[model samples]
Target chain A: MSDPAPQVPPQLAAYRATIDNLDAALIHLLAERFRCTRQVGRLKADLHLPPSDPAREEQQVARLRALAEEAGLDPVFAEKFFTFIVAEVIRHHEAIRDELSE
Target chain B: MSDPAPQVPPQLAAYRATIDNLDAALIHLLAERFRCTRQVGRLKADLHLPPSDPAREEQQVARLRALAEEAGLDPVFAEKFFTFIVAEVIRHHEAIRDELSE
Candidate 1:
């Protein structure tokens, strides 16, 4: 169950609004990323290539971890986040490969 | 434990690199959002105000779910994402409030 929402004063509403805006931007950004990655998945399927790439994944995780630290975010968390995303991308690629084969 | 990384072909390496770039952009955007939200927390503490706002939270969630739909993302997923972030933001606000008082 979710925690009870707080009772924010009128003056504080603007901050939450800003956060909402930011969240919207995040959604859009993620959509764009997926859109590009989807193309990669299709290309991989077209070439009869495998979905996963451990070396490239490792490189990306390391790069993102460093970048996260530079940006003052937890490297471990950033890596975990990317790991989750990479899994999803591969899943999509696998599905695309199957679809193209059939 | 994380799953073993895939062995991506050379052709796919470029795609992974693009994903990495997009992820970095996401991190930067998140950092910026938190920075703004932090200011709001401080202001709230200064005024001895509470952190959460149920009404605004609901409005934002509804707005985002719609935005997510327009962007081709899952509405339920978007709401959940905001709920998670809101929890974190409230936690931070609570901390700031305590620190200012102490």
Candidate 2:
């Protein structure tokens, strides 16, 4: 990586550093999230359960949207983000199910 | 929220609980991220700097993608997620700049 931008204002640089740290934390959190979901995927595969649960997903969307509002974030944006992550999880679940069946 | 699904396996329920907590944590983290970005936005406005920095954004995407690989997350997905958040931050920055100009 290149050296830090010396020309940037110190306060701005500090904020960017915090943002970068937060972003890294987010990636690690997402990795942990997938690890949990993978276990769930395995459990579902063992139980011969369906890969996707529409009802549960709907409930989670509503719950998260409320939480987003409480956190002063836009509920719609939160829902979109949650949905994106859930889609990835479901894809992994389906892959797991397929592998187990094969 | 509705009572826990009694029919769900305990293992599945536990995983779900962890997932729920992680999801909430993600929301809060995102909020904090925006909080930092907003500060940067205001600082940029105060300094009469531009709202968006394409070069810095490109650097961040590369940096985050590398970090994602280190964290075992899909680098492509991480880039997409980061791009989405940066887009929102830029929008907020633009709004802040507009407000200050007004």
Candidate 3:
């Protein structure tokens, strides 16, 4: 990666360094989240559980949207992000279920 | 939201429920993440810090990609995810810096 411009304002560069640091934290958090969910997936597979719960998903989306608005973030964007994460989770659970059934 | 099929395999339905629950947990975790990051942005604004750090960004990308691979996820996808999150964080930081400057 190219170095941040040497002559650019130091403050701007510092801000970016902090942002990058936080982004790394986020990735680690996400990995931890997926690991926990993977365990849940395995449990469900053992019990022969379905891979999606429409009602619960709806409730969560509504709840998170409200929280997002309260936080001054765009509710719609938060909803979209949640949806994407949930979809990925469902996909993983489905794979686990298939593996267990076979 | 439509109910999961009544006649569908109970196991599949159970799996979906678990997945939904896990997804909800993930949303809460992400919300918490953003909250902490927002505080960092505010601090940067107060100090007049820059909003992008190329070297640090590169380091974080490499770190996250490795973590993703170790977690059985795609490194490339993790990189993209980090890139997206960093961009968003930078945007927020820039806005905060502008507000303070003005």
Evaluated on chain B only, candidate 2 has a TM-score of 0.88
lDDT of 2 by residue, B1-102 (tens): 788754888999999999999999999999899888889999999999999888888999999899889988889989989888888888999999999889
Better model by DockQ: candidate 1 vs candidate 2: 2
TM-score of chain B of 1: 0.87
Local error of candidate 2 at residue B75 (angstroms): 1.4
Supply DockQ values for each candidate. Answer: 0.51, 0.74, 0.22
How many steric overlaps does candidate 3 have? Answer: 19
Off by over 4 Å in 2: A1-6, B1-6
lDDT by residue for model 1 (B3-55), tens: 68655567667866777678889887777777887899899788876787687
Q: Top TM-score: which candidate number? A: 2
Q: Write the per-residue lDDT of candidate 2 for residues A28-61, one digit (tens) a residue.
A: 9998898899999999999989989998899999
1 against 2, candidate with superior lDDT: 2
- Poorest lDDT segment (10 consecutive residues) of candidate 1 chain A: A5-14
Question: Number of clashes in model 2?
Answer: 0
Cα lDDT for residue B38, model 1?
Answer: 83
**Model 1: residues with Cα > 4 Å off, grouped in runs:** A1-11, B1-11
- As for model 3, its CA RMSD to the true structure in angstroms is 6.1
For residue A95, model 1's alpha carbon misses the true position, in angstroms, by: 3.4
